[model samples]
Target chain A: MPLPMTSNQVLDREFLEIRAKILDLAASFDRLDRADGSVVGDPRQSLVQEALSVLSSTQKDRAEQIQLLFSHHYEDDWQEKFNLPSAAKLRTRST
Target chain B: MYYFDPHIHMVSRTTDDYEMLAKMGCVGLSEPAFWAGFDRGSAESFRDYFRQLTEVEPKRAAQYGIQHYTWLCINAKEAENVSLSREVIAIIPDFLDCHNVLGIGEIGLNKNTKNEAIIFTEHLELAVRYNQQILIHTPHLEDKYQGTRMILDMLCDDSRIDRGRVLVDHVEEHTVRHVLDEGFWAGMTLYPTTKCTPQRACDIIEMYGSERLMANSAGDWGPSKPTAIPDLILEMRRRGHPESLIRKIVYENPLEFFRQSQGFTFKSPDADDASTINDRTASEPK
Candidate 1:
């Protein structure tokens, strides 16, 4: 019996929750920066920074872009490695 | 508002959960074979699990008026044990004829290991030999993208596979486009955390449109919500999407994919009920 709500109504209903999540994320970053040692040039930190930059992008497909950014690069012979009977070790990436 | 959950692990759930599902207008669901939280010891264990899928779970779901369909496989985690995995695969055909048994699935890469890939290919061969639909589970978290890539590559490489009959589940923004572009059905799993949320699913629906797409709770033993499909419906409704569009994604789309399987024979609950007799059915305008 309920009618479909408008987009503004949806945003109004979700605004506080979204704001709280943003604050939580900001607080976590603040806590991280306040810690003793710095993760300045660490690849993981760089990935996070890249992900944040993706979040600020104007692209409509930012989600896909960010997901691809965090994903493994396509290897032409990716399946060939599976031919080895032995279990694979995790592939370490420098970039 | 009737819906079908295309992928959920009801064996890990309770009768109370079934009651809740039926109460939420979930008329049907399909349970794909997956890891039982730990590595099952042997092929005999998989046989027992298959029996539960084909026999026990169907009766249990029937108690709540939910039509339960299932898939058969050793699951990717246990596929690490090649000897036991082969043993289990040999015995899977024994239950393929079970009325509730749909096909081979939740069969995919857990850690993207070589052993997992070998076993996944073997499962595909089995499904192809028997002419069954496939339900795939891509890896989670960090491994998701690569695992999905590997899965799609393998599936596409197999010329025996009919992409329309296959469902690649747990697809996200980066992976879903490829899955759909390759002509396979895609399922977005709605989890409370970790996997896709209702909001993200709504976005996917908006971007992808309703064709060959569906959503499921993926409610398993872990931190999952069994009523997540209804939650998706609520989210879709909240976004001002039409009821028809919402119903297509949550209900009709799943039915379209599931009907391709020889084992899927779903009876509408509305057929006997006086409720919504005036409403048009999903498939035919009556």
Candidate 2:
């Protein structure tokens, strides 16, 4: 049980601020990782998301950065988008 | 009048099954590659199973003029050994091209253990990779409840799976609502001793109304007869079930489910046979 006011306000405030930054980074990276991030319909991404969710925030942020860096080389989240319907143009070339 | 049995383990059954089912009006049957009532240790055992469902058994079925198709994979209870299960899974695609190999399953939780869950997810991945439908086996006896919960939980985890493309098999009264509520296909098995009988399966149909549902005989090394499904069809007719109602459970429902896997269409027999879903004699073998 967390005491009503036992934790330091400064530390709590700092945690919230860091968490916000982390989420923002995650959201943007999510977009870059998927050109169709609007639909996040790729189940493997859901697989990856579920896998990454188990990690701590620091690890998650690092993983997001890796995803962002790799995905920057392409126009879309090609890794997850390859077999899906939206990436039909890119899909034909790979085959 | 034709009937489709969604589940029959014909490997352990005999020539009598064919002669018996043919006379009873069983035009089409779907055999799920269930465990042969025991764990198969080697990749070779599963390979032979693949051959039987894909090659040997269908030939035997065709000779009887019964159209046979199969769901190919290791059974859930055996899938508890994740390593052996994966070995069985890897060999599946090789046999999938064989005649009547339709889907990668009878996959789900047997005892709902962690090992079973991992193997269940692997089966889901195979289904997505091949763009195939899945047939799930919800466990029996003591493990039934936990197995159903575990199967649904893993299924919900993967968005690649269309819940409608999965048939949760071996459903009894307690398990039907959970199977139906998830938007997946609900399957009832009619076995004389361990599982629900045909009479009970018909009772379930009466109570639930037969949409998104089907029934079968999971007859195997266990003392069950594959003709039980045809009996259920007859029981439905005896009680004044509409011809349309019997057709939905015995023919249309299973036909649609198997059709999701490419090239598994039912080419109805041109001959006069008792297997017609609406045939009054469909349940009695001459």
Candidate 3:
């Protein structure tokens, strides 16, 4: 696994600024996926899915990512709020 | 004796299909949302249709001891009507929570239209977002050869999707090799006309053997019968097909299919149908 961004890596301020910009781009890509539906299918969604997967591994760095990568979906946790049907509905039923 | 139909259309079929199918040892069926004969005017049409599929019908099937599952999506062939399909596909995720829906699917290219391809890609996106398996529909008749090829090509070209996560349904001699060779699951339809017959399908089983292969009855408004799968199995048994091969083609194949899918878990088998014997009447299920 890649090492997490330390206080110095992010505290450099210049790199944090760049990470913030990338996170903004990620947020924009996520919005495009929401509005266009096709965006989530774009090859870029693979990158985002990967980045999101990686963000789960580290702690303090993960917190920084929570602020960086997910401006809307993370901040809102809207997937839960949206009230999708219960997972059981999709379950295979008794014959 | 556990039979599974990975592709079926419940809109045109009746409750008796569940009863008869259950009695015939058909324990479960996956109903793909599709063009049910004519076109609809609004998103509300699809809403009501989804309601009937996920709510009204499954309860009816459960009453008869058959498990009814659904693949939710806008039909691909009608995706020529892209504007409406987009509207319908847009709302499909809202209905995903209904206990019977398996995924946003039975979606793919038809007429090989750019607009249809766009919709197909979007549906793929939805599956990825929701983490669900895809049930793709390859066009029929004249469109079969080229359309199936086109759908698989798009899936391959799209790096975000995996071949194993999709079911490229409605295979014939022309497309079965490519579908299986590509490592995607292949589904065969047993329509009396337009699709393969039981004898021919069994012959395909003999030739292709089995890997990621399943057979279904896309019984719809046409003269097609819902008993197509049963006929294929019956013919296979009559022609000296080993019981294991029949189980592999029908029961094991589909069961393993849903089992591999994301967020999908097995529903209990209808444990209460002790009264219904496996001896089914010869009449067709309407």
Highest TM-score: give the candidate number.
1
TM-score of each model, paired residue for residue: 0.80, 0.70, 0.69
DockQ leaderboard ranking: 1, 2, 3
Give each prediction's DockQ, rounded to 2 decimals.
0.16, 0.01, 0.01
Error of 3 at B5 (Å): 1.4
* Candidate 2: residue pairs that collide: B1-B276, B2-B276, B2-B277, B25-B274, B25-B275, B26-B275
Candidate 2 C-alpha error for residue B195, in Å = 2.0
In CAPRI terms, model 2 is classed as incorrect
| Model 1 vs. true fold: TM | 0.80
lDDT by residue (A7-77, candidate 1, tens digit) is: 89988877645643443343335435544698889998778768866244435455566556656765546
Candidate 1 CA-lDDT value = 0.82
lDDT of 3 by residue, B1-286 (tens): 6788788777788767777877777777888888877888888899999998887766666666566788888887778787898899888988888777777778986665666766787787688778888998887555666667667766765565767878888886556887999889999888754556676566567667888899998777666777778898898898787899998999888877887654355554655545332223223243
- Backbone clashes in model 3, listed as residue pairs: A85-B97, A89-B99, A92-B267, A94-B268, A95-B65, A95-B269, A95-B270, B106-B135
Q: Considering TM-score, where higher is better, how would the candidates rank from best to worst?
A: 1, 2, 3
**Best candidate, DockQ-wise?**
1
DockQ of 2: 0.01
